[model samples]
Target: MVGLLPRFRRYRLVLLGLFLLLPLALLLGAGLGAYPIPPLTIPEILLRGEGVEYQVLTALRFPRVLGAALVGALLALAGAVLQGLFRNPLVDPGLIGVSSGAALGAALFIVLIPGAGALETYALPLSAFLGGLAATLFLWQIARTPWGVQVSVLLLAGIALNALVGAGIGLLTFLATEQELRSLTFWTLGGFSALTWPLLLVGLPLALLALALLLPLARPLNALALGEREAFHLGVHLEDLKRRSVVGSALGVGVAVALAGGVGFLGLVAPHLFRLLAGPDHRYLLPGSALLGAILAVSADLLARTLAAPAEVPVGVVTALLGGPFFLYLVLRYKREVYRA
Candidate 1:
């Protein structure tokens, strides 16, 4: 622990910087769009409340920006928890089939549902959250044994579930109308253009629930870092930790995909970047990942909306384009570290 002092000191600085950066991300996200408002004047414009600028800012950008940050924070937080729980750098919420399940639900909703009613609007995201949560719960049950949940088995189950969801989506695609097809295609690619207060309301409570479940697991996760048996001897409740971790990841990724379809690599990238900078202390890694994830998501979203001028690129594509190379770097680095060990 003495050796970890310098690192923690550095982490505090990083944490402080990230806390500062988060609201800036929010301001920038709200400010720059098709109808540009100066970041500094956002507060003023919102206060006036009766002009086109005010309307645009209040009715449109604010909810989407807030949802983007929430989605990113949730995904990255889930990723951190899963990575720590599994003790695998490669693990993420996707590794347990939650994301695919949510995507599947969204696809199903788009292709089959015919109403634009309030109930339907609310149900689309609700269905998505339930789909992902159910899939993760099923995987959890399947991998459970008299001994304990098998991490290897859970991983394999997730892979199978993903493949199954892919097939299900393809069938949904086959049945969809051309318009529905277009909508789902855009959704799968991911964007925040359509987010609003109603949609945000659907996800807000569940996102909070996910946060509540995972944040408290930080210290036990730190214990698990020592080794499973060592952690068990130290009185860490491994089974309970694993269960909550899986559930939290499901809730988080479900809400994320529901709001912004399949925004990739924020999860894989954010926590990993913080781990590189500050060591793998869950106390810092969890919240640090959430903040960095918000920053990355906001920046990527800003580029998506502006780079084409009235024609928005999918935010998921933006995240993928940004994160793909970093992912490769991580793979190579992981290989080198494994070889050294």
Candidate 2:
């Protein structure tokens, strides 16, 4: 145990660093937009709350940055949980078709319900949450064999579901008015430009709740790394763990998708990067992934807004551009390992 102290201390330090870096990243993101508020002036502007800088930071950039961080953290947490539950590093929230399903739900709400009076406020998120849950249940049913959960089958089933959802979205787009089509197009591409405090007020609590639920499962996930039968023998309740993990992941990803649209690859990239840095211990991986994911999302949002100046790029485009090659590299390196597993 004494010999293990150094390693544990190192993990603590790394976590502390991540916790500290997150605020700095958020401040940088808030300051580095089209208006370009100086980092030093940000404090004054925030404190005084009477200037154009304050107005921009508070009314525009701050909410969007906060949303990005929350969405990123939730997505990464969902990915970490799903990967551990499935025992597959490649697994992400999107892999289960939840994101696509949520997209379809949002699309349906937008197209079919067009101008739904007061109910319009709740419609999109409710639709998305239901869609994600429905997808998860469907995936669970299709992938469960008499013997056990077949992970490969789940992956293939998810792919098929995503394709089906994509077709549905396409049909909706085809039928939609030009204005509605444009809204759908921007949403599918993903951005934080439309973020509002009301959405954040609802989403933050749910995402935090999901994160709290996942934290306790770290030890169970660690045991599962030894294989299901071994974990069962070691006194882990496999069914209970799976059930909670799936539901928790779905809840987190559903809220994230509903709030931020289909911001992809943060889930896949953040957890994998943290796994490389901090090893596969879920205790470290979960929080580390969350912090790193928040950083990535905020920084990416900054890039999305500033890189094109007047024409802001979609945050999803930035993430995909960065994560796509990394994902391909991971696939190439781990293909055999994943296949054998």
Candidate 3:
């Protein structure tokens, strides 16, 4: 424990740096758009609140940047919890079908509802949240046994459900009208272009609630890392932990998908990177993953917006491009470990 103290202190400093970097990233993201406000002037514009720069910052960039951070943090934290719970580094919200499930719900809403009205605005997120919860419950049921939740079975079930949900989304796509198809396409590609304050307001509470629930599980997760039987021997409530983590992750991921479309790989990449930096202690990993995920999302959004300079690539596309190779590398490097009991 004495030997570990130095490493823990170093890791804490790293986390502190990440926390500080977040605001800087947010400020930078706010300033780097089509109009290109200077970073130094951003505070003045925000304070004055009367000029074109202020309008762009407040009306456009601020909400989007804030939304991106929240969505990123939510997704990354969910990923860390799922990965810890399953004891598999590769598992993510998407791997377990929650994201696909949410996408299916969102796609269904887009295809079935035909209007830009209040009902449509609210209905999509509600549908997505329900879909994610349903999928999570289904996966839990499929993985449960008289003995305990089977991690292997859970992963397999998630893959199967993801495939099934993907098929549903495809069916929705096939049946959608032209405009709806366009909307669906953009959504799957994933961007924050459509983020608004109202959507943020709706999602914030769910994300925060999820975080609150998950953060407390750090110790239980650490105990579980010793193995389920051992964790139970140590008085960890295995069932409660599983239920809360899954439910919290589902709620957070559902809201993220509802708001930002299908931003992939942020969860997988962020947690893994933090694990490398902070070791696998869930206490640090969870919060560290959230910070790194926010940075990755904001950076990706920045590139997505400016890379094409008025055209804007999907943030999802950017994350996929970044995460795909890392995922492949993880598979190649850890295939044996992942397959081991």
Best by TM-score: 1
Per-residue error for 152 in candidate 2, Å, reads 5.0
**What C-alpha lDDT values do all the predictions have?**
0.88, 0.86, 0.87
Clashes in candidate 3: how many? Answer: 0
Superposed Cα deviation of residue 185, candidate 1 (Å): 0.7
Tell me the RMSD of model 3 versus the true structure: 2.0
Candidate 2 global CA lDDT score: 0.86
Q: What TM-score, computed on C-alpha atoms, does each candidate reach?
A: 0.96, 0.92, 0.95
Query: Which stretches of candidate 2 lie above 4 Å from their native place?
Result: 1-6, 115-122, 143-153, 336-341
What's model 3's TM-score? 0.95
Instruction: State the displacement of the C-alpha of residue 302, model 2, in Å, after optimal TM-score superposition.
Output: 0.6
Candidate scoring better on TM-score of 1 and 2:
1
Q: How close is candidate 2 to the true structure, as a TM-score?
A: 0.92
Q: What ranking of all candidate models by TM-score puts the best one first?
A: 1, 3, 2
| Candidate structures ordered by lDDT, highest first | 1, 3, 2
Residues 1-341 of candidate 3: C-alpha lDDT, one tens digit per residue:
99999889978987998999999999899999777999999878878869877888888899999999988999999999999998888888876667888788788889988685778667777887778877888898998999777767878998999989988888888999999999789888888988888888988888889989888889999999999989999999898998888888888888888888889999899999887777888889889999999998999999999999988989999999999999998888797775783
Lowest lDDT 10-residue stretch of candidate 3: 332-341
Q: Score residue 335 of candidate 1 by CA lDDT.
A: 99
Predicted structure 3: lDDT:
0.87
| Superposition error at 124 for model 1 (Å) | 1.6
